[model samples]
Target: METTALSQDEVLSLIVSQLAAYGFSQLAQTVAEVTGAMVELAPSSRLSELLYLGKEQDESEELEPTEFPTEEDQDEPMEGSTDSYSKYLDFDIETKPIPRPFPDYTQLYYTQHKGPCRCAAFSADGKYAATGSHDTSLKVLDVAKMKNRSGDAGDKPVIRTLYDHVATVNDLSFHPNGLVLASCSDDQSIKLFDLSKPGVKRAFRYLQDTHIVRSICFHPSGDFILAGTDDNSVRIYDVKTFQCYTTPPTTADLHRGGITQVRYSSTGALFATSSADGSVKVWDGVSGKCVRSIENAHAGAPVSSVRVSRNGKYVLSAGRDSFIKLWDVGSGRELVRYEGAMHSRESLQAAFTHNEDFVLMGDENSYTVLCWDTRTGALVKKIQGMLLFIIQLRW
Candidate 1:
């Protein structure tokens, strides 16, 4: 008797369905090393349709790639409040020294974690900072008092360190109310901490997921929580009822790959999701319907993160293609492109400066933070000094 060899899709399916103790780890590692398999999706499955495999690839061709603006040419300031928006419009990128708005920005205020800090978030009031690490610990620190971990502050600035997760923490989000902090981990659980109360070693509330929770965000109203999980689903849970309200009506509406990041617009009128399927979709916050889709958003490379602009007029997305592009929310057109960061491997987060004057992200290869002038796409600054990968960034 002869046996047929397993196909790529068969192997991927096997990796996805198998339990941890049955040698699945070894098989999965081998497959990832050889094929660079970011996420497993069956070829004939409804989800795979988003990949545009085979004949469907022709349809994607009709959506041409964005034409990036010339580096020296600055377009009209994005529609935002009349502060700093137009200040840099006429500043010559080639001649002007990079703006030194904060002279002390380069001075490091280090907070050491026993393990690499994977996710971090600032409370709505910006008085507190929370970081979750691979050590399965979450630390809340007072931002104003944070000093070099090796210096006099030496753990004194740490408000609380909670150990509740059995696995690495993947993401953290703060409720708009500023008194609650939420954290998600690879242990397949999300924990909520009451920041107003102290001396609590464990989360006050817990929520469970079928797969690893990769990213999370809170609704502007603080009434619900949004989570992106490895199950290829974006879920919304009510804060009061703890009931999951995410119900997609069709398979076509679902992401074909694991969601890397999910974020809501400033006004909570819409939300955006980036997937390993190389797509960024904007969905109506009320109806949960995909209002705009940017297919092949990164030329078939997995989009690692997506952020809605502070003004709610643009979207910023980072892809494994090593490019960060800005898109107009109303027109669904790519507006600007920023490069020079080596980020083809890790699922890194990108952010916009508070005033939306600059774009910021981490360089996985160099382990440094890269900031670019948003209007000109010119390298504004590169801050270094990371012992390992910079998984997440927030300014």
Candidate 2:
């Protein structure tokens, strides 16, 4: 069985989350202080105090005060829907956001290079994480040992660096077995790492034919790989033979512009592709036949990214239009338009929480992270951070 170690920060974050869930706000705040991520209520919740309360009230009285019904709480639930998360991305309205104290999120960087990590992938066993940078290299880190950088030998998270790519490394995908890791770059080459070797190095043969791979994923069996390209095609190549096994399918040639991303569903029975043409297509992995196509997924701009839920029942896609749409996998119908607090000018990226209760997104335009309630379609949290540019974020 594969094993992954938990970082010290993750353990602390879990503790803080538990504390907050149990209503131990003071204790959660104390843990946040020790963990360096403040556990505070929503700004709106702190916006007003009961004007009727006397200034002489004791602290215990304030702690046990009942929550007044919110304005929307008094309204009847919609006919078929009890909550809303189907609005478009617009922040013109003024409303109070709900409280969400999620502490497991953090930004990691090297104090030395401060590398702009454009893409990253975690190993299958979760023991390692690899990041690609504009510096034209890929660095792997020991996930279990990651901690605050102290500029010492063991203080940094990075464990090894590979220098095969001549341009910015664009993406990474580790094999399901966790022994081999593949990385693609702007230089139009895909290099595989043989992690079991005495010295960390690339596979003897690297895939050399492709048009600037923007996304890549491994075949669940680990013998083949699929790559999405700027040329509007998806190419499958054999890992050992380094030969193209099937005709590269190009969706961009017919006005789609380029293939932005491709992801295999959880069971690997279906693979989905998002394109510059503002569409999302689910296709048979081996047969190359389109299973379901969501035309005009964004309709205004290209769908930049796509993700399938853990159970393979829903599809989540984010776009240049600053919106994320969730769809039912079987009927190919749009289920919800999640545009709560996200207003990002940067290419959007998002993911489903393990349980799919909430969705998290990188808000590049606002320079913060936003979490939306899946059932209510409300922005419950505005996670704070100080990064001027967040090149990559992974759940």
Candidate 3:
């Protein structure tokens, strides 16, 4: 049997193929040994040329290059890269441990109001949570005790207040300071309540004669309040004066149909509104000018809710079309679309988590709150129960 020695090109091709198959660490070790011998014999030879040839061979075999951070690069992480060494590259996969089965949430004491509680909000301290029900009442629950007594078989939440509204309360929000609570109702009014005061008289109320108030939110700085109504316009009210600072019909032509959702950007420079006109509009919060308008944003369905991420980079909207659309705020371009079993033509609500990395959404028939990965549009987790609506605990 005659043993034949491999040619330089053949040897280089084999090494490159192995490198592409096995990855960088092993390839580096193998190349070091071969290159050392070649250097000893021909010190002036171009090692770079040899490496280039290896890369060509690897490419011809349709092998992807291994992405490994160098020592210096490891010390200074790349921009937008995760700090975890395990996630040095986006392609790296990390599997989470399977979650333990949920306890019987049915045992958790929850108040069943007369009508559908379509919206909810929590105070800044997370001590209180308020739900707006179609029964024409707003129920405030002591959330702190609810968590502590969750293990108690029959522990019920202490009702903080049973504030009354002439019509169904459609949306509610706690001021950033946690001292004030605001509720919007079908009666076409936005009510402000001072929780610090003991009696109902201390709770102040404000009225708007526009059509039913569909959604309401406070500016991040708590200086102003924004509300969307069925009158096809958005109203901005000054918090201190308790008067309309910027009246509706300012940009009335922007939304031809009823406005369903309005949200202020985290930076307080811009705000977004979604409407039944099949459009979403971004507006300058200070100048009261329309910045950009997205037409047919949710097709023929009215956008039921709109939320801006904490970082002010993305906006999320859910509508009757059973789809959630994500948009880049700066360019006003649609980035991603997410569809889930819970999204429906019926009014659905969506909000960004405190970290802005996850989105929570709910609908009338949904028995669980859907959590989605904002970056990938993937379903991350589900909070099981008959969820009416969800709001981030105000901070």
Candidate 4:
């Protein structure tokens, strides 16, 4: 010790080695980088022999009591403490005031898929949502955490990303129970995903169809699924048995063109279908038989989308002719027609707003949304600069 002195580099290296031995590799690296020192630890055999050779008989270490309270004592809150967050303990959604934007604000926006998003469906309770894209992927999102236009709050709305379809995903439907989501794709496949189960990477039930499925909807009871295909066929599949029942072939009544959209009435007593054949048909929900048909519904233009009113007394249909016709479900007659929306090629969706007071449809040509008075059939407002290729709409 009297004859030997350690160099600065040796001292730094020794400090780094000790720090690494105590499992502080990050701190050791930082020291090496800052001091320009080489960090080489002692050989394993020699270090082990030197460190543990005389420590075999050492007594086990015991902890001495400190001023801090034990775990049991800390269970209770400290004296004079106040619960500043007590107001946030429980939230009453009904009492909360809804935010109303003057010009329109996007409640949710996501760009995870590679291709265009084709369809979206909200759960019955509006707490969850599922979207399908042309990129052959489905994303399940948490509605409660949907981000705003600012992209600051609730940033990560998507909770799960699912990839099972080989081709483009066309439609998505959430069961009435809201726990299961069904999706149809142009790949000629249908898949069911149960959202209650965690870490689900694949569908729980997979169905293969002969033709490409364009639309899918779950029955109000969640016991059956109705699908419309590119083959101009409508079919129902039993959820429990996985048995598919095709509509009886009636050459005179069967749709001649591709089935674009299918939906069930609010009462589940009747279901509606819009086809590329330029017709809309309403069928009995129980017997699965066509009851009413509006032939040449769009004046030879393909009926793009159809939706049953909440009362089940009316049906709202959109066609490539750029008209939204309100039809009487009982008389099978057109009630009122709302125009001024440009839709020529894509299957654009039309929807009814609160209490069926106003009907709305997206214009594929101008990327605008047109709202009209349901009773007067007069255009009310035009929301411009909306997204394109809107295939579905719900109140």
Quote the positional error of residue 344 for candidate 4 in Å. 0.8
Q: For candidate 4, write residues 75-109 as lDDT tens digits.
A: 22234432211111111222322221122324455
Misplaced by over 4 Å in model 3 are: 1-109, 150-156, 199-202, 246-253, 363-366, 387-395
**Model 1 lDDT vs. the true structure?**
0.75
Query: lDDT of each structure?
Result: 0.75, 0.66, 0.66, 0.75
- Please give, for residues 311-344, the per-residue lDDT of candidate 3 as tens digits: 3456788877877888876787887677674555
Best by TM-score: 1
Note the residue pairs that clash in candidate 1. Answer: none
Superior by TM-score: candidate 1 or candidate 4: 1
* Model 3 clash tally, residue pairs: 1
Displacement of residue 29 (Cα, Å) in model 2 is 59
After aligning candidate 2 to the native by TM-score, how far in Å is the CA of 21 from where it should be?
A: 40
Off by over 4 Å in 4: 1-112, 147-155, 387-389
Candidate 4, residue 340: how far the Cα is off, in Å: 0.8
CA shift of 133, model 1, Å: 0.5
Model 2, range 1-395, lDDT digits (tens) per residue? 57576666655665665444333457767878876964342111111122112232353254543488532233323344323222211122314333333335565654333357778788867778888887877778877667455667765677777778888887889899876779888888888887767466555458986588888888666767887878666777888677775433555322266787878764455678888888887766545667677888887588878887644556888887888888876798887677853434655677765435567777766667777765456667777774654544564
Model 2 scores a TM of: 0.68
Looking at model 1, report the run of 10 residues with the lowest lDDT sum.
41-50
